[model samples]
Target: MRNFEKNIKNKAYAFQLDPMPDSFDKVMDALEKKKKRRFIFWLWILIPGFLIAGGGLLINQMYSSANAQVQAQSLKASHLLTVLFKENKQGLVHEDKYALTETTHTTTPENKMNNRPTSETQSLASKNNQPVFIKESSNQSAEFNNRNEKSFVQIEEKTNMTQVPSREKWTPIIFSNPYFVTFPTHSSNPVYSRTQIPFTKSTLPVIKSNSHQTGRWSIGIYSDLGVSKNIFINNKDSAGFGYTNARQLTDKFLFSYSAGIQFRYSPVKWLAIETGIGFTHYESNQLLSNAGFSWTTSGNNNDPDTALTLSSVDPQSAFGPYEYQNVYDYISIPIKVYYQKKWNWTGIEAGGGIIFDLPVNTHSYVADENSNMSYLRHEVKTSRLNVFGIQASANIHLVFHIKKFGLFAGPTFKYRMNSMFDKNYITRQHNYFIGGEMGLRYHF
Candidate 1:
């Protein structure tokens, strides 16, 4: 019995080292196989990641181009409006009926021998009803000396000034109106210099305020890339199976991605409500080690009774380390409230929300010795995962406006509110997602 027990102990020891090959060439071969498997695993992740990133970039470029065009058109319309207003003021002033008049005074000397005002001066004085006066000066010539002769004479003179009407006729230039200015007509068309259209208050163009337009609706498309980790709680049962003198199985963060469409409505200048539906995919890589017990029986049917032996062996050590990959897919619906502050061309938005995560699929893969991978059957069903699967999220966005479109980028954080898996499972896990989100939105 002692020898049989020793043999069983030796066999258990040999099983521990069975997966590690003795030959250097065999080790290299195993390493090469691991490399191939790793390459394929990363390929699966990288291909779709690159595709989603590329698609997002393409859409952003298209939106930017369209936004730039719309901005240019808006600027053009503003400049045209300014020009139209200026031309309208000038035309009104030129057509004004008011005129300015000037008066002139002239004096002519009267002959002393025949001191009488001229008929032309008398006729002008009679029409104007003015009197003529004469003055004597010491420097007057004495040659015609009658001491009574006056040296200076003042005569009332009337000057007829004809008022000339402005020759530039105010022929209404219909082409210069705001309608034509805001929406320019083709230069090749016949230009109408005049129109019978009368100017009225209703026909005048209404100027829109420069304030930000609130109470508007907008639609957006967003994509995010990040890393996620599975946080296992209530893991005491599973922890017992860990390798000797080692901590329990732990998960590592892996790349994750999400894409979705959002709709937003603003009922006030600074507040908005938003909702969106999206697909979120999370992946985690884990190193799992466990201790397992097996029973061995010796002595064949010839013996009345067989000797039974029980042994404990590190399952990970016997079969090589286990590489576990957990993938979760969810269709998420989010409802959020936001507060936004806008500047002339930029805006800031802060929001928090609740998300309902409906499980679409769940998969777990385990890679063993020889780099062979197989799917593990899980008791937690995808349909049951939604029972407590909800998330709380918050984000702050920086938005730049170009015409009717906005470009936004921000950091987003999410915390799972409940266990992602059923609580009855041996290991219950939750997840946290943190990442940068970027997108483009069109405002109406």
Candidate 2:
């Protein structure tokens, strides 16, 4: 054993003295070197890289500006060229059409014959440098000749003049002329002129008016489920037919269902209000223990057994354990004004409001035969529960948009402001309660 101990000690000593690098020291050296490279190398890389990026951005902007200026100049030149060409073409067309029209008109002479017109009278007329002769005999006379000469002179003097003369004899017929017509034979056609149009202000296409604006009001059913204390306890030692004043009885559930109007204001989404009357039901159950201490004054019946009962050493033996089931049904009117910030029509809301409950009724079921099953019921009948109440709860809502309707489902916590059972029961010992509910809501 001594040798064994010495061998172990020798091995331990060898291991302790071995020359080896500590992992912590190596790690610290590596970390320090990495930190040094990170600061120096990263800074070196980032400074140059950022400078390059900024330079590239500046170059891009300069190039874009130059290109835009060139494009603008080109567009302006093209527009001016188009306008000039259009005006020049229009003016040339107008001049050509007007010249053609002016050269196309002609004039003609007119003559009217009476007696000579009864027969086929072939007359010769002269135009330009051609001569036209009529078949009137020279055998008429000098007077007739003179008259004919005079008429010829008159006709030659006024080329476009109109004359009216009556015809008498065939040997030397006097002609009646209504108009003088001069035919040009060749005339140019009329020309149509087109004028250059001036530039007018240009406008982009305008879209028609929009028809997408809308206003909406919805009808819906809203509900809340909550729980509140039935009786607020001030002193723990006080006698009562409910949970001890020290340890309070929590309300299980006060669920309400109502139908009301829902309204929405646009631009501010997820904001709305609901108003309606609801049927609210609240129920609670508790186990109550009766105190066996009793006292009677000396003025009572002087029977010996009565004295024994009054002065009993163990008064708890007179009663059995019992359970109480409390139920409250009320017609509640709830005006809940809630606001919601919705994410895709699904969100959460927190609201609190007053619930006016006309206590329809309250019933208590005693667990044992010795229990005064009608004690609490008789009290309710005497004074129907007209209680002012308040409930506060938060709910996660799922809004389903089906055409113009909405369906929602979520959990809610509702509490009655006042206790269901009048805790001031003269004969009951203690009251305790616990409950929960589920509900649905619809919107239109």
Candidate 3:
């Protein structure tokens, strides 16, 4: 605080100065000289070292080659000497074994006792010339060999030959292959007996069958349910029922269903002729707002009427906020032709044909809106439903086959081709239905 600023300027200062530029040049020169000296030293040392290594390897290869040649020659000479020595020894033994001997019988007691030498002086290899080997007869060898080893080398050969089967007689087990070739054998052994079975192509049944495959009969049962619509099918184009055009009545068409049994015949692989009898139930629903639009043709559930004619009477009445049902039941007979195709497990068939239906009856019922439209019924009878009619239909089905039974399902369409009443009858209906059908069938 007293004189700090003045003392700072008076303090001794040190600064490092850069080396002179020439100093860099001197350092680089020294490095180059040092590197050159190392290069020269290694060049002189490596050349002579490589020469020495190369010469030593060459000398070693020459010496090893010469040594190996000498070892091979020595081994061959030793093997030859061994073979010659064995041959000479065997020749000497052979000569000694059959040395010439005079025929003398040692019968006298004095001669026998003198001839029977003992210990080292015995007749082992004396120059007296005696036979040490004997030519063997079959009986002697067999009899003597059995004394200790029980026919060691003699009978053992015959026994082994009898035990082992010969290669020519060996019958390999040809595992049970039905298609294998059978060879004939004359051997009495049961194992060698092979009975040849002659199989001809004519013995096999053909894959293309001629029976139920085509020209056959089949039977089935089917059922289907879907929407139904009734329309006027006349040349007059006449419209009636004044309250509503039947189909325009709110909620006009709901559902129709049928169940039936069918008998079908196939005349060829791809074509079928079928006929069936079935029961059909058709229904239509209509909404009533202004106290039910009525059907004058019906007798209001056959209720008591004051007037003469049922329609002139109280005339069926229904209230608002209710659903009315018009129902028709029919006994249907169908004549159809189908194009059928089949495979191992599944098939498809599609065809179109005509059907005839005889109406069983017609009835009308009602359901209250408060009841969630459940069928609360009130029916009226009418003779107008007995008319016979005809229809055209087409169907396609996918069939799943299991053995003799087949299950089939697909879409079906049918349209009434004719009016369901006499020509003069009013309110003629030609009903048509669209729905899926399923059936079960059996093959013979």
Best by TM-score: 1
Q: Which stretches of model 2 miss by more than 4 angstroms?
A: 1-215, 222-231, 236-243, 246-268, 288-319, 343-348, 364-378, 419-444
* lDDT at 246, model 3: 32
lDDT of 2: 0.32
Pairs with steric clashes in candidate 1:
none
TM-score order, best first, reads 1, 3, 2
**Model 3 agreement with the true structure over 303-414: per-residue lDDT tens digits:** 3321113222224422333344677788889999989877534578999788888877776433211111112223443433436778898999876554355667778999
lDDT of 3 at 152: 15
Q: Which of 2 and 3 is ahead in TM-score?
A: 3
Q: Backbone clashes in each candidate structure, one number apiece?
A: 0, 27, 0
Tens-place lDDT digits, model 2, residues 6-70: 99998987885543335566578769957965674465455435544554454333322232233
Candidate 1 lowest-lDDT run of ten: 157-166
Candidates in descending lDDT order: 1, 3, 2
Task: Give candidate 2's error at residue 97 in angstroms.
Answer: 52
lDDT of 2 at 46: 56
Each candidate: what lDDT?
Answer: 0.47, 0.32, 0.45
Better of 2 and 3 by lDDT: 3
